[model samples]
Target: MAPRAGGLYVGKMVRFTSVGLRYAPPAGSSDPGMGQDVLSDLSFELPAGSFHWLLGPSGAGKSSLLKLMQLAQRPSRGEMEVLGVITSRARRGELPALRRRIGVVFQDFRLLPHLSAFDNIALPLRIAGRAELALRADVTEMLRWVGLEPKAESLPPELSGGEQQRIAIARAVVMRPALLLADEPTGNLDAVQSRRVLSLLQEMHRMGTTVVVATHSESLVNAYPGPALRLADGRLER
Candidate 1:
């Protein structure tokens, strides 16, 4: 179901206006060009401090949509506006500054294999030049929130799939970006673990981060019971 618009509030803090995208096959490929389009004139509005789900079958272009939001890929056509800032003609330097206000968790759990979980979570803080004392406190609190405090010093290789997923989440949210994108965050987790992970996300939303999570799990969708932007054949199905 689409989220009801009017009652939420006027002058909402986030919006996505008429976004579009496409992807080509990688080099050295024998596959014929089929004019495949990954996204088509997608438009959605996300209010600040809200949670939205992007749900669809595999290969429905959920991840592609997210990359567009993150400005990792330019749109084939149309516009995406973030916090009233239009993206179409944005400079390369402008992107990084904009991205600092966003958080992302990919399906593969992109944690550094050589770094311990604590260091991984602190990466964003360190990059932003946060002080050592503040970094330590924030990173430690994030690990504890994700129930990974005991394994804070463990490298990614030493953790199970669920633990690694938690670490990825902790890293993504450490800086508390304005927008949070989680792609199939609980895909590898069991029911109990999935709930725990979802709860962590919910806690973030309560603290006013606009969140969008893409998942195919029906049970998880129902459990959270939020509006979903359903994608089909690489386009949003209204």
Candidate 2:
């Protein structure tokens, strides 16, 4: 059954049931138990179009969990379903189509150094085979939306950290993905910049994108009233 939100049935965008993950030990590790589970028995349901904050300190498996959700890694045990598809058991051949439905913002702002902001933002649409003529207007609009219309021709290295992050965000959502996952997106920005970025994400949520952000910023999380999923020692706190 779909979960109810605001008196309406909202389907689950992501679901984890007794999920666990552990890295394999190094090739020459003397101790067989060197590798330990970074995430364990995590069970949760994120309804469609919901906004969530994934809060945890360093090494609390926040990124690991996001990786699983992004289908970059499979759970060591249990099941994970994302976008209504069983991710844990999905085949490699079927993952690309599924992954294209998700947008991810990394902590490092992984933008191409040589590409202009406008081009970077248009990369996803181009990969989806959008016509160049149509892409120009859409990309221009996204740049304006992110308040970077003037910097549309600037390369990533030419922009400030905040600007680069914003461009990265604009690129991620250019395709209007079903799910948006950001990892420590505001970690490098000041309080004000962080708020601005958060606001952009909020706008995306308002447009019906399910958003999940992994961050250690308590003040930022507190400033926004949303359900928080906290992790400690690899386990989710209720």
Candidate 3:
């Protein structure tokens, strides 16, 4: 597709037009790019049902960019449309549903320490108020998909880092979100475990979910080459 204004299409899985996000909220100033911004004058597009790598060094606004894509933070200036919703102008009450359609996997594997693996993967379904019996079977299948079926009863603290990360992936995809974002998902795993996690993410992309993975691992980038959006010193480099 040919580019539109700001080099972004009108409707995509993700779109940013002259977007800038600051260290603090826009605070009714209307022009957020004027502040000391973490991401300044960024503009790009992630097409529906496509996978892309977010490549950048540490402190290069990678995390900050993902935060915007996932609607965790609003674009302080310019426009952002994620999952078909213009999040910058979306009402506060309307964002929850949009967020539910997006999944996020973090570097720390933010599983609840108190919850068992089964419950942890089931958390999203439970939050959406699914029937208890149905959600159990779904969660169980997810555990098997991630090769963590045996750890269903294990707590996060009891599981190895690899196991915990797998559980996190399962939880992130349990709802079959339209878009998935991962922040250094393989950062804590060994080479073998990293391969496993990356495969799961690739599988998700193959199933038609738009995916973006942020990573600093050169080895990972080499192993799984794809179209990438690179950041440098708070600006898009590609």
For candidate 3, the per-residue lDDT at 75 reads 85
Alpha carbon lDDT at 182, candidate 1: 93
lDDT of 2 by residue, 1-238 (tens): 3454443326999999999999888898888656889899999999898999999999999999999998988899999999878888888888888787788988889999989999999999999899999999999999999999999899999999899999999999988788899999999988788888999999999988899999998988879979989999899998
Each prediction's RMSD to truth = 4.5, 3.2, 5.5
Using all chains and alpha carbons, the TM-scores for the candidates as numbered come to 0.90, 0.92, 0.91
True-vs-predicted CA distance for residue 165, candidate 3, Å:
0.6
Q: Where does candidate 2 stray beyond 4 Å?
A: 1-10, 29-34
List runs of model 3 lying over 4 Å from the truth.
1-11, 25-35
Write model 1 residue lDDT over 9-47, tens digit each, in one string: 224445555666766677776666444688887877887
Q: Candidate 3 lDDT (Cα, whole model)?
A: 0.89
Residue pairs with backbone atoms closer than 3 Å in model 2 (clashes): none
Ranked candidates, highest lDDT first: 2, 3, 1
Candidate 2 residue 162 C-alpha distance from true site, Å: 0.5
Q: Per-residue lDDT for 144 in model 3?
A: 93
Please give the ranking of all candidate structures by TM-score, highest first, separated by commas: 2, 3, 1
TM-score winner between candidates 1 and 2: 2
lDDT for 211 in candidate 2 is: 96
